[model samples]
Target: MKQRVVPIAVLAGALFAVNVVARLITRFGFDGDDTAQYRITIGMFATIGVILASVAYVRAQKSLPSEWLPSLAAAAIGGMLLTILVGPFLSGGYPFSAGAGNFFSQIWLYGGFAIVGILFGYWIATMLGRDYRSQSLKAFTAAKAGKPRRVVRR
Candidate 1:
């Protein structure tokens, strides 16, 4: 349990770190530049997507989705909450100081990016026949090949 908790915490911290970097860049380097800020936001989200996708792809190869997915989900949620609520303060702003529209849009973007990343990762794993389910199926078939099936009684 401690082992599992550690990885999830690390992933969540990583996500928050990404958010912090983006906020810092926006606050200092791109201040008063909406275009630059927008670009930074997009870049940050893309990075988040890639991070999650990588985690998904790697995890899918090692364990069943049921076993590992909750960890990933928890990490994402934890990261999102931290990024949304605590992140603004780092830039000397309130979470919703950007206005209600921007606050909600950020939520939408976070959820959208996270889902797409997970799907993309799982899709690639499935296509490569490296996901746990695919590997399990292959192993099952291989093992059954040497065994004779018992006839079912009516």
Candidate 2:
């Protein structure tokens, strides 16, 4: 449990760093316009989706949710925090300005998008049945190539 938590925390931190970098880039690299900021946010989410899908394709189904969900949830939380805390500092704008809604809205927006991405990845992997095929092939090979089968003693 301790070992697992450590790695998850580290991965979540990495995800948070990605979000921070994206936010910083959008804040400084482009015009301080709402549309540009929104576009950058969208691109960041899309990148996350692609990454999750790739991970799902490579990861085994049995361990998919367990291994990824904690880190993902942590990342979502950390990402939201990064956006809220650093948004104003880097963008020279308040997180919830007069035009924007409450701060919690940011949390919902980021969480919803992250969850959707993760679910989409998991669904695609499951629909492809790669895990099942891999296990089946392994069983078949083991049974066929291993030593002769011994008769069962009732």
Candidate 3:
């Protein structure tokens, strides 16, 4: 359990690091520009979405949430923290500079990204026939295609 937790925490930290780099880039590179900062945020969200979707699609064959969900949740939280705390700095302001507006926006953006990413991941998983729904569909398809009419036996 300790071993597992360590890796999950590391993964979370790594995800958070991605946000850190992005935030730093936006903060220093696009200073004082709302338009550029917004663009960076969208780019980060899109990147996260693709990553999560890929993970879900790949891991759909697995039956254990204990294995994946924790990692994902950890990653999301880590990323959110990095963005929220470091993002304002990247945007050329202190962490809580704009009163409630920036703080809330950070929360909203982080939450939005996580939700969107998870949905995309789940959707991919379903589409790949690895999820339960996909398995059912596969079974139905196989049944429909595998045989001609058969006589009922009592």
Best TM-score among the predictions, by candidate number: 1
Q: List the lowest-lDDT window of 10 residues for candidate 3.
A: 56-65
Put the candidates in TM-score order, highest first: 1, 3, 2
Which model is ahead, 1 or 3, in terms of lDDT? 1
lDDT of 2: 0.66
As a whole number from 0 to 100, the lDDT of residue 97 in candidate 3 is: 86
Per-residue lDDT for 58-108 in model 1, tens only? 999999889988999999988999999999999999999989999989988
Which is the winner by lDDT between candidate 2 and candidate 3? 3
Stretches off by above 4 angstroms in model 2 are: 61-68, 86-88, 92-102, 132-154
Q: CA lDDT, every prediction?
A: 0.93, 0.66, 0.71
Candidate 3 lands at a TM-score of: 0.71
Each model's RMSD to truth, in Å?
2.8, 4.0, 4.1
Q: Give the clashing pairs for model 3.
A: 27-90
Task: Check candidate 2 and list the clashing pairs.
Answer: none
| Candidate 3, 46-106: lDDT as tens digits | 7766666666555555645456766777777776777678656655677788788868877
lDDT by residue for model 2 (12-79), tens? 56656667778689866876587887888778767765655555555546554676666656655665
Better of 1 and 2 by lDDT: 1
Candidate No. with top lDDT: 1
- Given candidate 1, what's the lDDT at residue 33? 96
